[model samples]
Target chain A: MARLAVDVMLKPEILDPQGQAIARKLPQMGFEGIAGVRQGKRFELVVEGPADEAAVERVRKIADTLLANPVIETYEVHVLSDN
Target chain B: MARLAVDVMLKPEILDPQGQAIARKLPQMGFEGIAGVRQGKRFELVVEGPADEAAVERVRKIADTLLANPVIETYEVHVLSDN
Candidate 1:
């Protein structure tokens, strides 16, 4: 089986309030020098095959159609190697 | 500036209903062979310096205390190169 990681993030143009909240709170918590922050979603999928180009493509399709909303968010898919 | 990516995930033993819901829906949507699915959070932090070890350590601390709940979730921090 192959494992794929899909990271779904809001587009750069979109405002991320959750990330803004964290960025604002960090300094108060004594963590300084952070310029900005963005929050997103991550998914791990175990598929019934090797982590090949075909598998990556399939996962990419899955990411596009189901995992992410194409209007405001984008996603990236990566293959995870067996350990 | 440097960018750091922090991934926060539920512990393996924890239940992920969102993931389960996705997994169940995928097959119904005609996507097959997905053995399992797990959902998590991803955060991108832009700091006012190079992505040095100190920055990674600082992000790790932030992730532990604020971004992730240590009881049921764990986090990984990675330094991202300027693009």
Candidate 2:
């Protein structure tokens, strides 16, 4: 089994109140010098398949289709450790 | 500054429609035998500070107070390699 991490982020042009809320709180959280905390959805999957190029493609398809809102968001996928 | 990865997930008892939807479709996407795609919010923070215990504590407070809903979600924080 392998773990996949997908981050779904809102498009730059889109307005995200949730992201805004999170960003605003960062400073208060003792990260006084930090900025730009874009909030996004994260998906961690335990896929039972060979860790191969084809597996990544399959995960990408899911990421592109149902996992993210293509109109208002962009997503990036990461393959974490395999077990 | 260090990158902090915070994964905010719904409580175990909470019915997560988004998570449910994602899991249902993952198998079709080449993860044919895998399941359990939990949907959560991710925050990548570039905090400017010494990577000290205090800094992590401060970030934790912020995560508990604003970034995550205490009643509905639980969050796990990870500090990535500093840049």
Candidate 3:
């Protein structure tokens, strides 16, 4: 079995309202010294076989087409385990 | 500056409807060979200072109390960069 982790984040130019809310709430909650916060999505996938180039490419396609919106978001794939 | 990443995932025992939907949709979308898919939240935080133990702890506290719902989710914190 193999595992792949995809991290999808808002583009640097995009505005993240959810993260802004957290930044505002943090200070109110007495947590200080945090300058910024950005919230995103993470997807963990378990593939039935080895996480080879083909498997990675497949996941990348999924990430690009389905998991993330290319206009406002970007994604990166990491192979966590391959065995 | 320092960077902290919090990954919040549904507990294994819990049912993830969103993930299930994606898993089912993947095959229909022409992506195959994936056995399971789990969706989660990833928070990227930028601290004004070093990402030491104290900073990590503060973020952990934030993650525990505000970022994640303790009932249905579990979270892990990773210090991405410290400078």
Candidate 4:
């Protein structure tokens, strides 16, 4: 089996309130020096084949169509393993 | 500046209905051969320092305390870049 990863993140221009909330709480929790934070989604897929270029392309299409909202989000696909 | 990533995922033994629902919908959406899907959280942190071991350790601690629930979830930290 092959493993692939799809990371979906909001556009840089968009406001990420969730990330902001965490950033705001960091100092209070004694975690300092964090300039910014952005929260996103990670999806791992176990597919029945080699994690080759073709598989990456297929996963990219899947990410574009289902995993990410093009209107405000973008996605990146990576092949984690081929075994 | 340094950029770090913390990926928080549910433990393997934990149930993931969100992943299941996506897996169920994949075939119907013309995406096939995906045996399983696991969804997780990805946090990107821009810190005001070098992305060294100390930064990684700090991010790991932040991940453990705030980004992930140690009871049912686990997290991994990676240094994306150091500038």
Among the numbered candidates, top DockQ falls to: 1
Kindly indicate the candidate among 2 and 4 with the higher lDDT. Answer: 4
User: How far off is residue B2 in model 2, in Å?
Assistant: 3.5
The TM-score each candidate achieves on chain A is 0.95, 0.82, 0.95, 0.96
Q: Best candidate per lDDT, number?
A: 3
lDDT (10s digit) by residue, model 4, range B25-76: 9999999999999999999999988998889989998998899999999888
lDDT, candidate 1, B5-70, per-residue tens: 999999999999999999999988889988999999999999888788888998999998899999
Accuracy of chain B in candidate 4 (TM-score)? 0.97
lDDT of 4 at A81: 86
Model 1: residues with Cα > 4 Å off, grouped in runs: none
Least lDDT summed over 10 consecutive residues: which range in candidate 3 chain A? Answer: A46-55
- Model 4 chain A: weakest 10-residue lDDT segment is A58-67
**lDDT score, candidate 3, position A59:** 93
Best by TM-score: 4
TM-score of 3: 0.96
Would you estimate the TM-scores of all the predictions? Answer: 0.97, 0.73, 0.96, 0.98
Tens digits of per-residue lDDT for model 4, A14-65: 9999999999999999999999999999999998889888888888888888
| After superposition, candidate 2 runs with Cα above 4 Å error | A11-15, A25-31, A70-72, B11-14, B25-31, B50-52, B70-72, B80-83
lDDT of 3 by residue, A12-44 (tens): 899999999999999888999999999999999
CAPRI-style docking class of model 1 based on DockQ? high
Q: Write the per-residue lDDT of candidate 1 for residues A1-83, one digit (tens) a residue.
A: 99899999999999999999999999999999999999999999999878888888889888988999999999989887742
Q: Per-residue alpha-carbon lDDT of model 2 for A1-83, expressed as tens digits?
A: 87887888888798878767777866665557665566788887777776567767777887887778899989887787776
Count backbone overlaps in model 4: 0
